[model samples]
Target: MNQPVSGFSKKSKAEKIEWLAENYLQNNLRSVQVLKNYWNDDPSLQQLHDDFIENTLSNYYLPFGIAPNFLINEKLYALPMVTEESSVVAAASNAAKFWLERGGFKAEVISTEKNGQIHFNFFGSEKVIEAFFEEIKPKLHSSIQAIEKNMKARGGGLLALSLVDKSHILEGYFHIHATFETLDAMGANFINTCLEQMAHTFEEEARNFEAFQKKVTYPEVVMSILSNYVPECLVRAEVSCNVEELTTKHHEGKHFAEKFVRAIEIAKTETRRAVTHNKGIMNGVDAVVLATGNDFRAVEAGVHAYAARNSYYSSLTHAKIEDDVFTFWIELPLAVGTVGGLTSLHPLTKLAFEILQKPDAKELMQILAVAGLAQNFAAIRSLVTTGIQKGHMKMHLMNILNQLHATEAEKEKAMEHFMKNTISHSAVVDFLGKLRL
Candidate 1:
C-alpha cells in the first residue's frame, strides 16, 4: 500500500517523478523514461508549460491538423483543429470540400452577451428586499466600473443587472443576475471579478439599509461566479443548394437529401440517438475549441444544456427540403474568446489564431458554428450512403497496425489488403499473421 506523499507540489520536477515512479509505478525504469521522452527539447518552452499548472510531469500531446477550403460568409478559411481522435479532421475537410461548390457555409453571430450571478439568501420581508435591490442596483453597477474600464473602452462591458426572486424554488433564495459584453476575450476572470465586487458591495449595502437593520436576519451571500450557460451568446451557420445538387457518384441527390432529413429527424425524436448525434457535432466543434485555447468543457456543458432547453435532448443540427431546395443549419450557443486566457499564452494557440486570420470573439463564434455544421453534414452523408463504419474503420487502420507492431513494409501491405477487404481487429490480425507466414 502506498502512503499519501506530503508537500508533493513543493518537490522539484525530478523529485516528483522519482516519487511517483517509486510509489505508483513500482520504480519501473522504462515508465520513468517515457515521461522524460515527452519533455520539450527547448528549455524555455518546457518551463513555460511547467508554469501553466502545478504538478507538471510531462506534456501530453495531440495532433494539430488543418481542414482547408472552408468558405464562410464568402470568405475562405483553413480551420485549425487539435484532437486525438482519428478521422475527425478528415471528415471536417471532406465536408468543407463538399460544401465549397454549393456556396460553402454561411455563418453569423446572433448575440454576444455573457452572464454571471450573485446568489444570496434574504430571510426578511419580500417587499423590503425588492425595494432594497432596486435602490442598490445602480450602486452595484458603479462598484465594478474600475474593474471593467478596459473592457468598456473596447465597446464591451456590463449590460444590465436585475434581481431574480427564486424563493418559490428555495426559501429565502434570490440572485443578482448580470449580463456583459466581453468583446474578444473569453472573459472568465473579468466576469468573475465583477461578480465578486458586486457581491461585496451588495452585502455591504444591505448591512447599512434601515429595513435590513430592522430584520433579525440580514441578506447572506451564498456565492458569486460566472455561468457556463450562455444561451445569449449564440451563432448560426448554414448551407443550402438545389436539392438536385446533392448528387454524388454513389447516391442520387434527391435520395440523399431525403435520407439526410430523416436521419436528423430521428436524432431529434430519440434521446439516445440525439446524444451520439450531437457528440458527432462536438467532435468538430471541440477540436477547434481546443486548438484555439477556448474552454471546450464549458462549451460542451452549455451546448448540451441548450439542446435540452425545450425540456428534451435533441439534435443540434437541422435539415429541410422544400420545393427542390435543401438546407441544413445549426444554431449553437458558443461563448469563445480570441484574446485572453491560454489564447495568448500557449504557443500553438497563438499560431491557431493566426491560421484563423485573427478573428474577434463574434467571428470565432461564427467559425465554431460552421465547423459543427460541416461535421454533421459529413457524418450524416456517410451514414445515409456508404455507412459510417467503412470510412471510420479505414481511418482507424493506422492505429490498429501500430498496435500490432507491424513493420513499415507490413503496414503498406496491410493497407493495400484492407482496401478491398472488410476491416476488423480479428481480420487485421489474421492478415498480418498470413503476411508474416
Candidate 2:
C-alpha cells in the first residue's frame, strides 16, 4: 500500500516525479521517461506553464487544427480548434464548405449580460429585512464604484443590483443578485472582487441596522461568487438554403431534409438521445472554445443548464423546412472573452485570435455559435444519409493503425484495403494478421 508523505509539494520537480513514479506508478521506467520527455526545453517557457498550477508535471498536448471557410456575418474566417477527436475538425470544415455556396452562416449576439450573487441568512422579520434592503441597495452599488471604475471606463461594468428574498423557499435565505456587462473579458476576477466587497458592505450595514441591533444575531453572509449560468449572455447561429440545394450525391434533397428534421425531433423529445446529441454540438463548441483559450467547461455547464431550462434536457440545434427551404440553427448561452485569461498569455491563443481576424467578445460569441451550428449540421447530415460510422471510422483509421503498430507499408496497404472494404476493428486486425504472413 502506498503511504502519503509530507513536503510532497515542497519537493523539487524531479523529486516529486521520482516519488510519484515509485509509489503511484509502480516504478514504471517507461512512464517516468514519458513524463520527463514532455517537459519544455526552454526553462523560461516551462516556468510560465509551471505558474499556471501547483505540482506541475510536463505539458500535455492536444492537436491544434483549423476548420476553414467559416463565413459568418458576411465575413469569412478559419476557425481554430484544439481536440483529440479525429472527425470534429473535418466535420466542421465540411459543414462550412457545404454552406459556403448557400450563403454561409448567419449569427447574432442575443445579449451580453453576466451575473453573480451574494447569499446570506437572516432570522429577522421579512418586512424589516425588505426595508433594510431598500435602504442598503444604494450603498451596495456605491461600495463597488472604485472597483468598477476601470471596467466602466471600458464601457463595461455593473449593470444592476437587486435584493431577492428566497426565505419562502429556504428559511432565512436572502440574496443580493448583481448583473454585469463584461465586454471583452470573462471578468470572473472582477465580478468576484465586487461581490466580496458588496458582501462585506452588506454585512457591515446589517450589523449596524437599528432592527438588527435590536436582535442578538444579524444576517449572516453565506458566500459571494460569480455564476457560470449566464442565460442572458447568449448568441444564435443559423444556416438556411433551398431544400433542393440540400441534395447530396447519396440522397435526394427533400427526403434528406425530412430525415434531418426527424433526427432533431427525436433528440428534442428523448433525454438519452439529447445528451449525446448535445455532446456532439459541444465537440465543436469546446474545440473552438479551447483553441481560443476560453472556458469550455463553464460554457458546457451553462449550455447544458439552458437545455434543461424547460425541465428536460434536449437538443441545442433545431431544424425546419418551410417554403421549400431547409433551415438549421442553435441558440445557447456562451460567456466567452477575448482579452483576458490565457488569450493574452498563451502563444497559440494569440495566433487563434489573429486567425479569427481579432474579434471582440460579441463577435467571438457569434463565431462560436456558428461553429456549433455548423458542427451539428454536418453531424445530422451525415447521420441522416451515410450513417455516422462510415465517416467517423474512416477518420479514426489512422489512430487504429498507430495503435496496431503498423509499419509504413502496412499502413499504406491498410488504408487502401479499408477504402474498398468495411472499416471495423475486427476486420482491420484480421487483415493485418493475414498481411503479416
Candidate 3:
C-alpha cells in the first residue's frame, strides 16, 4: 500500500532503496539476480528502473494528496491516483465534495454479464458458420457443464453466446465469433481455457477443417486474443451538486464546475490533444493495473480503442449539470486486477497496494474510475484556462534550470522561452546563456 506521503521519508537514498527492495522481493534472490543480471548490479540504476517500472506499473497512488469528498450515487469514496497534471484531484474532489457538502453526488452503475469473445477459423468457406452454429451451440452447454464444478459452486456460470459474422482485417482472411459469458471472473483465464477446449472439440466434430485461433476480444474483436473489454457490461455514474455549493468559491464547487464545464472542451478532444489527454488517464489506470499486475498495455490499448468507439473518438469521461446540481461521469472498460499479481514482488507496487489496503477488484475499479475522472478533470481544466503546455513546460524548465544551475533571473528567462513551447533542452540553455548569469 502507498503511504500518505509516498517516498517522503527524509531517509537517505540508500535507505530508501533498501526499503523498496525488501518490500518488492521479500528479500528474494530474484531482485538481486535481476539487479545484477540486467542492471549490472548498479544500485542507482536498479533503483531508477524500479521507480520507473513500478510507477509505470503501480503508479496510481501518486495524485490526490488531498482526498476528494464525493458520493457516487450515495456511496462514499476516498480516491487516490498517480498523475502530474494540476487541479484534477482538486477539481473532481472539490466538485464532488462541494456537492456532498450540501447533499452528495448521487449516481448508479447498471450491471450486465461481463464477457470477452472467442473467434475460430475452419479453413472452409465463410458460409459454414450459419449451418455450424445449430450443431455447436447445444454442445457449448456440455462443455460449460464440465467447468461448472468450481464456478457453479461460486454462484456463477456460463451465461450466453452469440455468433458474429466475420470481420476482415486482411484480404481473403476472416474468422467466426462467439461470445461466452464467464460470470464474475473478470473471465481472463477461465474464458480462454474453456473456449480453447471447446474449439478443439469443434475441430474433432467438423473433422474436415482446421481450427486456427480461439481467444478473447476487445470492444469489437476479431478473436486473436480476447481482451476483457466487455461492452455489454457498463456502469454509468450520474452525480449532482447544488449551484450554491459550486459558486461559493469555498463550498460552491459547481460554480467553478460550470465555468470549467463551459470552457473545458479542449480537454475532451482527440488528435494532438488526445495524446496527453489519454496519457493523463493512463496516469491513473496504468498505476492500478500495475499494482495488480494486469497487462496494462492491453488495458491501455482497449481503453483508447473504445474511447474512439463512436464516430468521433474523444475523452474517456463526460460532465454536465443535472437536478439543480453539477454532475460528472465516466464509462470505460475497467479491466483492472486485484490479486495474483506482481504487487507482492515489486517493492513500490507492493507499497502502493499497502497504502490502498488492497481493495478487492470492484473496490479497485472504483479507485481507478475515480482516478480516471480526476485526471480528465485536470486535463480539461488546463486546456480551458491556459493550454496543456504551460505547467508541463514549467516543470521541464525547472529541470533544465537545475541542471544548468542558472540564476533566478536566468531561470525566469529560461521559463519564458521554454513556455514558448519549443520543447527542446537546447532552447532552455540558449535562454539561460542570454541572461549572462
Q: For this target, which candidate reaches the highest TM-score against the unseen true structure?
A: 1
TM-score of 3: 0.64
Ranking by lDDT: 1, 2, 3
Regions of model 1 farther than 4 Å from truth: none
Q: How close is candidate 1 to the true structure, as a TM-score?
A: 0.99
Model 3 segments more than 4 A misplaced: 1-108, 112-114, 122-128, 144-148, 167-185, 208-224, 248-259, 263-276, 322-324, 343-354, 386-437
- For model 2, what is the alpha-carbon lDDT of residue 420? 79
In model 2, what lDDT does residue 400 have? 91
TM-score of 2: 0.98
**Pairs of residues clashing in candidate 1:** none
Error of 3 at 116 (Å): 3.9
Pitting candidate 2 against candidate 3, the one with the higher lDDT is 2
lDDT of 1 by residue, 1-437 (tens): 99988999999999999999999999999999999999999999999999989999999999999999999999999999999889899999999999999899999888889999999998778899899999999999999989999999999999999989999999999998999999898989999999999999999998899987876568999999999999999999999999889988898999899999999999999999999999999999999999999999999999999999999999999999999899999999998899878999999999999999999888999999999999899899999999999999999999999999999999999999999999999999999999999
- Please give the lDDT score at residue 140 for candidate 3: 59
